[model samples]
Target: INEDSYGVDDEEEFHELDMTGRVIANNYRIESKLGAGSFGQVYLCEHVRTHEQWAMKIESHAMNNNPQLSIE
Candidate 1:
């Protein structure tokens, strides 16, 4: 897997905060950015307590109108 971690620099930190708002479900913390596209961005996240990791995708609603897909 790509090991290029993020949030260590200013630009990445800004993206991290903007995309994830720090953490989700009060359990996962974003570790790095994986990829991005017109839809939005994907991230590498870790469980705060268990340290387990997973990939997360955050889609920008403003980037798409009358979407064909949704996470739910």
Candidate 2:
């Protein structure tokens, strides 16, 4: 996908903490980093069954503490 389509300024925004390992949430397994920010990281994931590509944005501790930064 084009970089502009994701609306991310840089790939660095998607860095994940070493302690934060891959997780399966809502039946989706996070594959890799797609993009990120101070609040969270967007992961490139796939459907276990359908094998479809999808993006999953996970909130970080810093973001959860700050109520102002919210995704609409």
| Candidate 1, 37-70: lDDT as tens digits | 6555788899999999999876544434535534
The digit string of per-residue lDDT tens for model 2 on 1-72 reads 112213334435434342123446455666777776776667788877888978876665434557665532
Candidate 2, which segments miss by more than 4 Å at Cα? Answer: 1-23
Q: TM-score for all predictions?
A: 0.59, 0.57
Go through the candidates in order and give each one's C-alpha lDDT. Answer: 0.62, 0.56
The count of residue-pair clashes in candidate 2 stands at 2
Best by lDDT: 1
Candidate 2 has its poorest 10 consecutive residues by lDDT at 1-10
Clashing pairs in 1: none
